[model samples]
Target: MNQQLIAFLAYLSPSLFVITALTSWYQAGLRPTAVKKLGMISSFFGILSSLILAYAVYQQDLIEISTFSIYGLGLSLRLDTVSMLMFSMIAILSFVIMRYSLNYLDGDHRQGTFLGRLAATIVSVQFLVLSGNLAVLLASWILTSLCLHRLLVFYKKRPGAIIAAKKKSIVARLADISLLIGFVLLYQIFGTGNLEIIFQNVREGISPLLATATIFIALAALLKSAQFPTHGWLLEVMETPTPVSSLLHAGLLNAGPFLIIRLAFIMEATSTASTLLIILGAFTAIYGSVVYLTQTSIKTALGYSSIAHMGFSLMVCGLGVYPAAMLHLIAHSFYKAHSFLSSGSVIDLIRAAKVTGAKRIGNPFKIILGILLAIAMYSSFAYLWGVDIQNEFQLFVIGGIIVLGLSRLFSFALDSNASIKLWFQALVLSAVVALAFFSLESIFHFFLMGNVPELTIPSLSEVILMSTVLTLFGLVVFIQIFSPILNQKSSFQALAVHIRNGLYINVVFDRIVRAHYHKEDSNSRIVLEEAEIGKYILDSKENNNEEQEERLA
Candidate 1:
C-alpha cells in the first residue's frame, strides 16, 4: 500500500460521507428511501478505508498527511496504530448502526435529514481520530457533539428527549470550553499546536502551565465520559430513537478516554491530572456498577453499564495503561452497540426470565473462600507470566480487577451442591479468561509500544489510588453475594432508591435548566405514549380478527 494511496483512501471516507450528507438533505423529501442506501455506502467505504489504512500503517509505523496550515496548527491526518484502530472500529460500528436504522426509522418523516445528520456526525468523529493537530482535534470534538445533539432531540414532541438533550448540551459546552482552554494554554506554552512537537515538550519537564492544561483536559474528559453524579442525562436518553442511543453510547461516549490517549505524554507528565482521573474514574465506576443492578429499565441499565465501562477506561488511562484503555474502549463499543441494537430481544428475554422467590444468602464461609481462591489464582498467574507487580503496577492492578470480578464465578462454583469437578472447572475457566486478558493487554501494548508509554515506577499515592480501585470492585462483589440479606433492611432500601434516582445529581442540573427553559413537562412522554397506543390498536385488530374467524366457523 503506497503512502499516497493510503492517504487517498483515508480521505475518501469522510469525503464520501460529506457527499452522503448533502445528497440526503437534498433528496430527503423526494426519495427518502435512497438516503439510507447512500449512508450505508459511505459507512462501508469508511470501513474499507480503515482496513487499508491499518495495513499500510503496519508496514510504515505512521502516515502523515498535512492538508494545510492555519493558526499555528497543521490541518493534517495522522495515521498510526492507535488512530487506525479507532478508525476501523468507529467506521464498522457506524456501518452496523446505519444498517439497523433502515428498519428502525421505517416510516419516519424527513428520514433523509436524520440520516444526513447521522452521516455528518460519523464524519466528524472520523476526522477527529485522524487529526494530527490540537486545533483540528478540538474542532472535530465540538462538531461531533453538535451534530449528535440534533439526533438526541430527534423526537421533538418527546419532552424527555428534549430535556436530556438540554442537559447534555450544557455539559458539552463546558467540556468544549475546558478542552479549548487547555489547547490555548498548550499553544501559549509550546508556541505550536502540532501534537508531536507538543508531546516532545511534555517530556522535557512538567511546568505549572503544562500541569494546569493537563488538569483542564482531564476535566473535559470527565464531562465527555459523563462521570458519576452528572450521568443522569445519559440514563434518561431512552426516549430518543434506538439508533441515536447506539451511536451515542457506542461511538461518541468513548471520546473522553480517546482524548486522554491522544495527549498521552501530557497525562503521563502531570501526576495531578492523573490523580484526578483516578479518583473520579474509580468513583464513577463503582457508582455505575452498583446502581445499574437496581435499574428496572433496559436502556438505563445499559446506560449505567456504559458509565461504568468509561470510568474503568479512564482509570486505566490515568494509571498510564493507555493500551489497556484502548482495548477496553474498543471491546465495550462493540458490546454496547449490540446491546442497544438488540434491546428489543433483551426485553423479550427479561419477560421470559423466571424469577425465583425468597432468595437466600450465600454462606459467608463460601464467599470468603471464593475471594481467597480468586486472589490466589490471579497472583499465581501474574507471577507465572512474569508480571512484576512492583514495576508494572498498571498491568498488575488491572489484571487484579478482572480477577476480583471473577470472584462471583468462584462464589457460584462454591455452592453447596457443587462437585469438586465444578470448582476445578471454575479455576480452569478463570485461568483461560485471565490468560486471554493478559494476552490482549500485551498485544495492544506491543502495537502501541513507543506511542503510549507506561509509568513503570509508581508513586506512593498513585499506588494507593490504584489499590482503591481494586478495593472498590472487591466491595461490589461482596455486596452482590450478600444482596439477598441486605435487601431486607430499610437503610439498604433507602440507598437503593437514591442510587436508582442517580442520587439526585441531575436534579440540580434540572433546577438550573428550569430557571431558564421552564416548560409544562408533566406529561411530556409523547413517544412512549404513542408506542403504547399503537400496540393497543394492534391488539384490538387481532382480537377482531379472532372473533371474525369464530363467527365464520
Candidate 2:
C-alpha cells in the first residue's frame, strides 16, 4: 500500500458511506429495496478499504487530512494504527448489520429512514475514530449520539421508544459537556488541540491540570458506555428494530472504551482517573451480570450482558492493559451481534419442548475440580507466554478472570457416572481455549506495543482494587453455579428483587422523565382525540337535520 493508494482508499471509504447515507435520506419514501442495495454496495467497498488500511497502515503511516493549516491549530482527520483498527471493526460490523436489516425489515414503511440513520451513525463513528483534532472528535461524538437517538425512536408511536430516546438524549448531552470540559482543559494544558502534539507533550509526571482533565474524561466515558444508574435506557430500548439493537449493542456502545484508549496517555498517567474507572467499571460489571441473569426477555438480558462486557472492558483499561481491553471489545462485539441476531432462533428451538424452569443441580466435587483445572490451565499458558505477576500483573489478573469464567463450563459436562474420560476431555478443551486466547492476545499486544502504554507494577491501592474485583467476579460465578441452593435462602430472594429492578435507579430516572415530558405527550394526544370526536359529532348533527327537513317537505 503506497501513500497515494492508502490516501485514496481512506478518502474513498468514508465517501462511500457518506454518499450512501445522503442518497438514502434523499429517497426516504420507503424505497426499501433500493436503499438496501445501496447500503450493501457501499458497505462492501468500505469493508475492503478498511481491511487494507488495517494491514498496511502502521504506527508511522500517519495520515492526516486537515481542513486548514492556520498556525497548526486546525481540525484534521487522522489515520494510524488505532484509527485503522476501529475502522476495520466498525466497517465489518456495519456490513453485517446492514445486510441483516434488509431481511429483518422487509417491506417496512420506514426501512429507508432507518437505514439512512444507520449509515449516518456509521459515518459519525468513522470520523470519531479518525479525528486527530480533539474538537472534531467531540463534534463527531455528539453527532454519533444524535444519529443513534433518531434510530432509537424509529417507531415514534411507541411510548417506550420515546422515553428511552429522551433519557438517552439527556445522558448523551451531559456526556458531551463533560468531554467538552476535558477538551478545554487539554487545550489549556498543552496550548493545542492537536492530538499528536498532546501525545508528544505528555510525560510521566503530568501537571495538575492534566490530572483534573482525566477525571472529566473518565466520567464522559462512563456515561457514554451506559454504565449503571444510566444503563436502564439500554435495556429499555428494545422497541427499536433488531438490526438497530444489533448495531447499538455491537458498535455504538464501544465509543466509551474507544475514548479511553484514544486518551491512554493521560488516563493511565493519573491514579484518580484510573481508580474511578476500575471501581465503577468493576461495580457496573457485577451489577449488570447479576441483573442479566434475572431478566426474562432475551433482548433485555443481552442488553444487560452488554453493560457487563463494556464495564469489564473499561475495567481492563483501568488496569493499564490496553491491548487486552481492545481485544476483549472486538471479540465481544462479534459475539453480541451474533447473539442478538440469532435470539429468535433460540425460542424456535425450545418451543417444541413442553419445558418448565429447569434447575442446575451442581456437584460440589465437580465444581471444585473444574476450578483447580482452570487454574492449572491458566498457569500453564501464563508460563508459556513468559508473563509473571510482578511485571504483567494486569494480564495475570485478567487471565484469572477468564479462567474463572471458563470454570462455569464444567457444570454442563453432563457426566453422572463420574467418568475419567469426561474430565480428560474437559482438560484438553481448556488447553485449546487457553492457547487460542494467548495467541490473539500476543498479536494485539504486538500491534499496540508502541501505540499504548507499557505495563507497570500496581500501587497498593491498585492491587486492592484488583483483588476486590476478582472477589466480586468469583462471587458472581458462585451464585450462578449454586443458584439452586442459594435460591432457597430468603436473603438471596430479597437481593434478587432489588437487582432485578436495577436497584431502582432507573425508577428514579423514569419519574424525572415523566414529570417533565409526560404532560406534553398526553396533552397533544388528548387534544387530537377531542378534535376528532368534535368533528364526528358535527357531521352527525348535519345529517340528522337534513333528514328531518326532507321528511317535512
Candidate 3:
C-alpha cells in the first residue's frame, strides 16, 4: 500500500473498532458476547495496523497530512518516531486490555456501551498522538477525555463511579480549556499551528508572551499526567473498571511527559521555561514517590507510582536526557501494565485462599523479582553519576533513599502470607542492582578512555566512603521510621488515611473550589421542588374541575 493509504488505514482502525462495537451492540442486544469478541478482534487488527505504520514511518522518516478543519483551524496529523512509538504502544495495550476486559467485565449491564467507548477512546488516543499541530492535538485530547469520562462512569448506578466521573470531567475540562488557550496564543505569536513551524520559530527565538504561553501548554500536560496538586483526578479514577485503569494510568498517562519531551526539544534548552519544567518535574518525582509510599490499596499505590515514574521521565527530559527518558517510559509502561493485571489475579487468589482457610503466602518468585529490581534501579542511578557527578549523584541518593523507605513500608504493611510483599521487595532489589551495574559500567567506560574528568567527589576511595555514609544515614532514617510504625493500629490507620485521601491535597483543592463557588441557588432549588408540588396540585385541581363540570352538565 502507498504510505498515505497505509497511514490512513492505521488511523481508521480505532474508528472501525468503534463501529464494530456499535454493530455488535445492535445485533446482540447489548449483552452481545459477540461484541466482546469482535471488539478484541478489531483492536488486534488496530495493533497490527499501527505496527505497519511504525515501519512505514521509519522508512519515510516523516509523514504529515491535513486531516480536517475545525472552527477554521487546520487540523494536521504527523507521524515521527515519538508518535509512532506511542501509537504502537497504545494499540498493543488497548488490544490486551480489551481482551482482558471480556472476562473481567463479563455480564456487566453496560458492557456494550463500555466496549464502544473503549474503542472510541483508543481511536481518540491514536489521533491525539499523531496530531501534527496544536489544534489537532487539542481537539483529539478533548475527545479522548470525553470518552474516558464516559468509560469511567460506565457503572452509572455506582455512586462512587458517578462522583469520580464528575471529578474527572471537571479536571479534563480544565485541561482542555488551558490547552485551547495555549494553542490560540501560540498561533497568534507563531503565525501557524504547525508544530514543526512553531519549533523553528522558538529555536530562532520566541517572544516572551509566546514563551509564557508555552508554559501554559506545559501546565495542561502536567494536569493530564496527574502532577502534584492536580493529581487528584487520577487517584479517584480507580473507581473505573480495572482494565480502564490499566489503560489510562499505565499506558495513556505517559502523554504528558511525552508532550514535555517533544516540546523541550523544540524550545530553547536554556530558557527559563525549560528550567521551570525541570523544577516541576523534580518536585513531581519527589512528591509522587513520598505519597506512593503512604498508599495502601494496591491500585492507588500503582497510581502514585505512575505519577512518580512520569515525574522521573520529566526529570530526565529536564536534564536533556531524552533517549534515557524514552527508554524508561517504555519499560515503565510494560511493567506497570503487568503489575496492574497481576494485582487483579492476586486479589482473586487471596479471596479464594481465604475461603479454604489457607493463609495466602508470599510468592517465592516475587522476592527474587524485588531483589533484581532493586539492583537494577540502584545501578541505573549509579550510571547517572557518570553523566554529572554532583547533580546526578544527589538525585541517585535521594531516589535510593526513597526506594529503601518505600520497600520497608511495603514489607511491613503486607500481611505475612501476602505474595505482593515478596514481589515488591524483589522488584526493588532488582532495580537497585540494575541501576548500580549500569552506572558502574558507564564509569568504567569513562575511565578506560583515560579522559576521566577530575574526580569531583575526590577518588574512588572517597566515592566509596561517601556512598557508605549516605547508605548508613539512609538505613538509620529508614529504621527510625519503620520501628515506630511496627504494626501499630494508629500508625497504620494514619498511613491508610493518608493514602486513601491522597495526602488530602485533593480535599484541599475541593475546599478551595467549594468556598469560591458557595452561592447556592436556593431559589432555583425551591423552584424545582415547588414545580414538582405544583404538578401534583395542578393535576388534582384539573380533575376536580372536570368532575364539577360533568356534575353541573
lDDT of 2 by residue, 1-553 (tens): 5667777777676677777778776667566666677789878888898877766765356776676655446768778777888888888888999898888877787778888888889888888888888878898999999999999989886667988898899889889999999989988888887887888888635778988899999999999999987887898889999888888888889999999998898787678998889989999998898888898888888999999999999999899999988998898899999998999998788787786532455567766776776787788888988988987887888888888776765554431344666656766787788887799889988988777888989988788889888988888887776666678899999999998877888889778666236656777887885887899899999999999999999
In order of listing, the candidates' clash counts read 0, 0, 41
Query: Stretches of candidate 2 above 4 Å error?
Result: 1-4, 32-34, 59-61, 70-73, 353-363, 411-429, 513-516, 521-553
Candidate number with greatest lDDT? 1
Q: Flag the better candidate by TM-score, 1 or 3.
A: 1
Worst 10 residues of 1 by lDDT: 515-524
Q: List the candidates ranked by lDDT, beginning with the highest.
A: 1, 2, 3
Candidate 3 stretches greater than 4 Å from native: 21-29, 67-73, 267-270, 350-501, 514-553
Writing each residue's lDDT as its tens digit, candidate 1 over 205-303 gives: 666898899999999999999997677789778887898889999989999999999889888887899889988998898889888888888888999
Candidate 3 lowest-lDDT run of ten? 447-456
Instruction: Note each model's CA RMSD in angstroms.
Output: 3.5, 6.9, 11.0
CA lDDT, every model vs. true structure: 0.85, 0.83, 0.66
Clashing pairs in 1: none
